[model samples]
Target: MTAADRSARLRGLIAPGLAALVCLAILVGLGVWQLARKGEKEALIARIIERSHAEPPAAPPPFADWDPKADEFRRVRAGGILLHDRETLVHGLAPGEPGRALQGYYVLTPLRREDGTTILINRGFVPTELKDPQSRAAGQVGGETSVTGMLRGSEVRTMFVPESDPARDAWFTREIPAIAAARGLTNVAPYLIEADATPNPGGWPRGGQLRVDLPNNHLQYAFTWFGIAACLVGVFSVFAWRRLHDPMEPGAA
Candidate 1:
């Protein structure tokens, strides 16, 4: 091709070429980020699994020494009395199998420890019908009792989740501060204890339903981003090839 024709073709490609370069860089960056997330998720899952299977400490650590990040998921024993009057039901959906989900609410009750400190205990799942304390009075263990459970941190609600209604005693998450305040509890711990699979007297509020099922789809996300980037490269290459091969416009050169 003549010099003028070649120059015109180069000018036509400048914007698209620049755009392709910038887009490719962004896509590659996203793919790299997803890969980093994958590694982080794997490590977190390993630590959680290890804590779940380890032997529980003889008793829960002192309230002064409590740290959610360091202490979460640690199995612990606590001797206390169940304050069933202040129980809260948090909305939840537990998986029954691979795809089936069982709609229910987790029963959270404050346990009054021997030292007078209180900690919220997620006694576990109960059907909607049994959510009312009166409906399951037989299961409520009054007076002093000892509980073995998994320590857990406060749960943050999802973006679209509705806020808890204290007036109606409806909760969407295990918000420690809110529940403690609403229940008029004092000297409450920042963390909660998910009671082990210990059966209640009436077999209503089943315990030991804790599941640490973290979604590890970061690898898939990384692949998707990488695949898009590859497709973009192929498309840009084909466009460049076509432009180069197309006959130059009729002109006096």
Candidate 2:
């Protein structure tokens, strides 16, 4: 080809090649960002696993200052009586032996401690059929019980659904304050207690559903993002190559 023609073709290649390079760079940046997020998620999972497996920490002082960062998932021991009269049923579904069965509501009762404050206790899982207040009241094991469990934050309200109305004993969502008001509890702690794997006599609501499994699929997600970025790079490379070598090709021109 003539020098003038070659020069013109080279100039024509510059803009499209540069544009593809920019797109490829942006994709690579996004891939790197996703990889970083994956690393963060893995680290968080590790922290959760370590915390869950570690021996329960000593019980904090009653009404003592509780900080989420310092005390979340910390093992605590407390002696309190199960206020069965005020047990609030938290709706849940569990996988059963036979097809998907609605595992009854979580038995969340207030535990009145020696220090005059209340902590919501998730006694355990009960089948939906057995959620009658009368039956649960009848099944109450009297006397003060020593409870070991993990401390959990209260459930937050979502925008779509209306808040739970405790007066009517209706609970569509786990609004702690509303539930507390319905149950007539004062000075309720900001957190709930998930009972440990302790065997309740008579096999009632079984405790120990606090499976601390951390979902760490972030690495896979990061790889997927990176793969997309790699594909983008491949596409960009081909685009650049075509622009540089065959700028005047029928369709390309």
The whole-model lDDT of each prediction reads 0.86, 0.73
Write down the lDDT that model 2 would get: 0.73
Clashes of 1: 0
Per-candidate TM equals: 0.88, 0.77
Give the local distance difference test score of model 1: 0.86
Residue-wise lDDT of candidate 1 within 1-253, one digit each (tens)? 7878778887888999999999999999999999999998888788778987887775554466777767777888888899988888999876677888888899999998888889899998987777678888889997888888888888988899999998888899899999999999998988899998889989968888887788999999999999999999999998887776678543525
Candidate 2's residue-wise lDDT over 1-253, tens digit each?
5677667767876887688678777767776777787787676566656766677765665467878656667667778888887888887655567776666777888888888888888877778777886654545767898788887776666797566666667676556677788788998887777887787765667677776665666667667767877887787678656655663754743
Query: Which one is best on lDDT?
Result: 1
Give me the runs in candidate 2 sitting further than 4 Å from their true place.
Answer: 1-58, 61-65, 98-102, 156-174, 247-253
| The best candidate in terms of TM-score | 1
lDDT of 2 at 243: 54
